[model samples]
Target chain A: MDFFKRQLPTLLVLVLGLGMIIQYYIPTTFSQQVLKNVNLWIQIIAAFTLCIGITSLLRTHYTKIRLQHSGWAYSIILYIVFIAMVILGFYRGIQEGTPFRWLFDYVQTPLSSTTFSLTAFFICSAAYRAFRARTMEATIMLIAAIIVMIGRIPFGDMLSAYLPSFIPGFNDMAGWIFNTPGMAARRAILLGISLGGIATSLRIILGIERSYQGKD
Target chain B: MGIIQKVLNVDRRVIYLIVFLAVAIPIIFPLNLPVTLTEEVMGVYNEIENLPEGSPILIAVDYEPSSSPELNPMTRAILKHCFKKNLRVVTTTIWPTDGSGGSIADKLVEEEARIAGKIRGKDFVNLGFKTGSYAVVIGMGEDFKKTFPKDFNGNVLDKLEILNGTHSNGNSESSLPNAAFSQDARAKKINSLKDFSYMVCIHDDSSVFTWITYGYERYGIKIGTGCTAVMAPGNYPSLQAKQITGIIGGLKGASEYEKLMNYRGEGARGMDSQSVIHVFIIILIFLGNLTYFILERKKTVRG
Candidate 1:
């Protein structure tokens, strides 16, 4: 029973992971067919996993509501919204001109947009405090940020028109910063992330990463 | 207790008020400042312009409503350009949250197609939101129909006349010019990722990485990206690697695209407000630094 619960999953992972890697190299019809079938299986599994996610969410909220936890009202509201959306989705369908579509467009979209727009206010306040030039590094960062901010917009181009022709304009300097130093830093980070991903993937395939298997 | 210290320690609410006014006033009174096209924005435009009329292009709308303000303009502009050039468009969304992202695409495509006098299933098709993210993208490379049997509207892929000349057979033989091409010689059938003339992803998040890795690196499909300004700098690596052909970054990029298209849209109008907020932030930064330095000098002199 223990083997069927834990070891079998890890064994399946190893076999499937190795099969996928090997399939990528072999161009035969059989290999291609295997890959196609595997992709179809993945899609099917993903659809099932979505159902599991919804059930988990419902369970969490239901427990919170039943226990009368602090802010349980919010949980109730979430349940109401969730059930209402699902019911509407099924009743009128999710197509355009449907009630579900109208709710998504008018209610969900505006709420999400409002939430996102609040970041600008927060960012402004945060920047005021954080961009202080207490050190040389801070000064350089502040200046670079200022240049990039100005250069990315139309005002920078207008300012460039009046400046002396010999000196590099804000737009030009910002472009250089983005292309050279910015590109270098981003590439280094990307390389690190890619290497880390590969290592983690390999660990999972080799059964060294058993965290995903959960405590048995 | 001095003015410099007071200025340095001003309440955050004051700062917020200033920012709010900075953005609001610009909307009421337009700046009409000239927007120069960046090489990055132009790169995307030029690539789309270079494609032959009726060539199939895939657009991945990988953003939710939160990013709609920034990404929607780019989507609208690109759709307009594609339809204007008489290209066939195939759009899908990887976003699965309430499926609003797919709906956004449908709404925009419908409006743009109506304006362009293009018919659905003929000039464009919305495959809608498909699950399995990278898996579905990779699957499309092998056999697109296998991954998406039917579009968002429940129309099967085989029956879509717009997909007629595409690689339906999953063989190299389908690459040959269709004999029936004379009827609609402009529209080419798209069978795989490589079959599309170009692929553009207008995203607010990290799905562009999946497209680049799976769609471009694996299948050799030329890809461009349109991203929110916040996510744009992160894409510089992909741009430098030539993994992506070009990028339209944020409202500014959208405005530049609009200028190229000679269509003034929300992106252009938003720039006036964006410019003001940026300048306001810069001024605040400068004032903060100036006050800090002044207080530091005063402290040294007193000592």
Candidate 2:
């Protein structure tokens, strides 16, 4: 039973994979119907999963509030927000005419915007606190960043105007760095990542990786 | 000693205020930065451009509210290109969270379609959010509607005149009458990548290749992507292999796309702020290193 349980998902996946591969040659009517059923099942599972996530969130917070932890005060605030938002969302609607629109537009949007905006601050602090010109490599990175920064702004043009004309397109050099060098570097990384993904998928298919199944 | 300590230790709020000012000043006063289009972004443009007009295209809006700032511009840029070429578009989302609700992708597509004078249920159709991870995508390849029962507005997809040519009353393989075709007959015949021209994945997540392999791979459909700067490099090989036609990574990619299309949108406006903050970070780094060096040298001399 343990062995079957362990290999069940793997076996099912193989069967599904075979079905998918063979569906290509079958009549569109038959293939499309099978595809449709699979899609509906997925939607059903997704709906249930959303509930699971919400329940997990509530369970963790309720447990915190129940135990009266040191940070229980914060948990209270979170619960209030979560419950209030859910009530507003479902009771009314997210349409512009509804009161929930205020919750969505003012609260949720701003919170998210503010969180995203913090990346700028964190990046700045990280750049400063962590950046050390300790080696030639560090120096090069610093200079490249500076050049890219300047190149991206209008100031780069003003600076380049004062310099010699020998450096053609120096004003737009940063744009070129982003377009060419940055893109080339990025492409090389993406290719490696894709290959890694393919390998991982193959491992799952071949059952070489069982970590996805819980360890005994 | 006290004075030195006071000078070194500043409140965190002060730093925040200064950074806020640094970013705000640039935005309030626009800087028409000299921007040149990168090949990566231009490649995205060229991919859409090369496609014959009225070609069907699948656009996966696989992001939620959290990633709107990055993915929105990418979507807008691609939409502008597609609409300009009169390409038939089918938009959908993967994430179930807020997927049924007011998703950013849903709002964007509606707003763009309105502005571009594209008719809904005709020019473009939003299949809304489908659940099931890779399963939803794979199912779409086999039978488009089995995954999406209704469009965003609760209309049966099979009933839509736009799908008349592609999906039959009885089956997906059977063609509908020419009179039933919405605006473009050819667009209706597109059941998969073999039917559509290309696909563009505008997402914040890294699982774009999963769709490429599952959906596009079988049909020989070309795939391209737009993602955050951090997610950009990971797609380079796909871009290199020509599996993905091109990529627009982050705000910079959006900016480049905006420039190439000659339509100044959010990417152009955001460029000033992005550039300014980057410069401020560089200055902070310089100051930090200088402080560290000076303090270390003094300690060394005293010892």
In terms of lDDT, which candidate is strongest?
A: 1
| Model-by-model DockQ, in order | 0.74, 0.38
Tell me model 2's lDDT, rounded to 2 decimals: 0.71
Query: Model 1, A81-163: lDDT tens per residue?
Result: 99999999878777789998898889888899889999989888877776788889888888889999989998898888899
State the lDDT of candidate 1 residue by residue for B239-279, as single tens digits: 88888888899999999999999977888888989998898
Off by over 4 Å in 2: A1-47, A73-102, A135-137, A151-216, B1-11, B97-102, B165-187
Error of 1 at B13 (Å): 2.7
Give the range where candidate 1 chain B is weakest over 10 consecutive residues by summed lDDT: B167-176
Chain B TM-scores of the candidates:
0.90, 0.87
- Overall lDDT per candidate, in order of appearance: 0.85, 0.71
Candidate 2 pairs with clashing backbones: A36-B146, A186-B233, A187-B236, A190-B233, A190-B234, A190-B235, A190-B236, A191-B237
Candidate 2 residue-wise lDDT, A110-198, digit = tens: 67767877877777767767788889999877777788667655556667888777785443566556557777877667678879987
Q: What local lDDT does model 2 show for residue A204?
A: 74
